[model samples]
Target: MADNLRGTSGPCPACGHVVAFDASTSTDMSVETVEEAQNVPISFTRPEMPEEVMDMTPMVDVVFQLLIFFMMTAAFSLQKALEMPPSDNQEKTAQAQTLEELENESDFVIVRIDRDNNITVDGEDAPSDQELLNKLREAKLGQLGQGVPGRTGLLVLADPQCRHETVVKALDAGNAVGMERIRLATVEDTAF
Candidate 1:
């Protein structure tokens, strides 16, 4: 069957004689002729390359525009704060005073708040908030007249049973009278 397919037993039309032809041999001869040509060495010369070019002007312009837009739209605020000036008459160096010296100080004013929410100055009952403020002002004035070297200190003595609102009111009154050095002292006395 293969010989018939390869035309090995076929008769040639031109010669009218029995001719044998192998299809595989003819295909192999064509392939070998192409491979012989491919095995010959050939030199390869590269074409000249064009110069590379890149423009960054547009990108840089866009970046600068974005920066300018943000700078123009950004909000800047000036912060407000309370400025305190140093006291010229007071000594700059702080001297630590003992508890005994503080207790024995004659210039210290005591503001007491009892459990009943009653305000007192130096053990004397103040009938109203106005009266307390007036007393605090008088103490400030007295200290200034006496040529006190520092600010007048107000010691707030609040009973443990006193309401927080009452204590705040007492502190507000002291602040209203311009008392800077206010200290809180809690007393454990059960008596109102």
Candidate 2:
């Protein structure tokens, strides 16, 4: 069937052509606006950005530092297990022995208090005093739940420069967990 519209096959009612142009949707704006009607006003100013593209030197440095931090923190298996040698004093020597050395040994709970009061357990740093206690409790509970033989103990390695308050806090934490087998590790020459 033939379609009825403005132009079909042949042209020539207005400006003669065989082709038909698609109409635009926008209204024609031949007139000027109030702003444009006025004379060329003062130019609005904008804050200037850096003319040259910014160098990423500082950003790269920070990224490298973060990378280094991650690299340094990445966990690795020890080449050989650490062993504590027998001390001259029998009491210290007996206490110095690791759980692995004991025949009917139980899992040990290790608490390390650095000079700055930073607490570490099983080679992992605890963020706060509460966290340290929680960790100690978990470790103690884990040992108790294991149904292992012999006595469970908590070994605290304190730095010589560690504050008295920090040591007391560690003691308090150990006490909170009902860990009585507490042994303090100190350097031979260091003043307590």
Candidate 3:
């Protein structure tokens, strides 16, 4: 009986919208009831596309874990640094003036290391690295031949045959005790 109306166009009988609907075409007229229409399978005239949506929860979790791992490890690392003198000529003039000013204001804390790895601070022997640190701290606080209370400068007179690690240890001690001005020089055996 529905085929008798084939190719015929008419106004919508359900919503009364005056829409020109063809009988042969698919529309809500084919759906008998709301509950039964929900059970009907969808038919497509073209090829069906696949759903390939990606899940980012695991990726975001891994990124946050790596960030936390690096942050925790970064705290346990030791940062060693050394400040070098200026290289340009204009800065050299400024550096010379600074040296002259320091020479007038305070005496440097002198540390000497011989070829046999013997360390001395102001003519006193420092048998160990801890002793060297203690002596450097004292020098930074005690009167450095001046009426002032402390010496910010440190001078290391090292012999050529000494180990490089020994020199590094001396410099590290000076830096630890807040000695801002550190200078290194080579000395002959007779000079000590």
Candidate 4:
């Protein structure tokens, strides 16, 4: 049937051989427009497209979900923070005490961090966190808090060249064993 339609078949049993015809070859022009009319063609072909074309909507949705999940679970600052009481210049100045005064008093634990990052609790070495915690806990046995008040406290006397991490560790250890009134100061107040 297709061969017959395409005029490729042999002589027909009723009429004869087929003749090639084209509608666009019409000898007459349009009556109203006076222009040549083009033949509108009918097609049965499937549109051409690449075999590997993919939809990215699902992948994008999955990526967004994963990003949200990570944003929800990721830790920004996990370690506990110190509760700093809000104050003005007057209160801060009133609360401030020199390292010399702290040294003279028997109320402070006096953990010192030298330039070499060596930690000493009241002139004794505390080389590890556990030892530092033990020392701090023992020193702060009955102290409620620290300040200009006559309460016991932990004093961190650090050198200028000590690593910031060492100081943070000391402060964390102090906080871990409930040393609320923790004070930090440099070994010498003078700067080069």
Candidate 3: RMSD over Cα atoms?
13.3
Off by over 4 Å in 4: 1-53, 56-75, 86-96, 142-151, 188-192
Cα error, candidate 3, residue 185 (Å): 0.3
Q: What is the TM-score of each candidate against the true structure?
A: 0.43, 0.40, 0.50, 0.56
Instruction: Please write out the lDDT profile of model 1 over residues 1-192, one tens digit for every residue.
Output: 232345334444445455444456344333233234334333345888998888899999999999999999999886433224476667768786654465457666677788777888766778788888887787777743344444476777788888998888777777777776677778755633
Best by TM-score: 4
Winner on lDDT between 3 and 4 is 3
Residue 133 CA displacement from its true place in model 3, Å: 0.7
- On a 0 to 100 scale, what is the lDDT of residue 41 in model 4? 24
The candidate, 1 or 3, that scores higher on TM-score is 3
Candidate 3: TM-score? 0.50
Q: Who is ahead in lDDT, 1 or 4?
A: 4
Which of 2 and 3 is the better model by TM-score? 3
Per-residue C-alpha lDDT of model 2 across residues 30-103, encoded as one tens digit per residue: 21332332222223459898689888999999999999999999998755322344556756544456533432
**Distance from true location, Cα of 104 in model 2, Å:** 13
Off by over 4 Å in 1: 1-101, 143-151, 190-192
| Number of backbone collisions per candidate | 0, 0, 0, 0
User: Highest lDDT, which number?
Assistant: 3
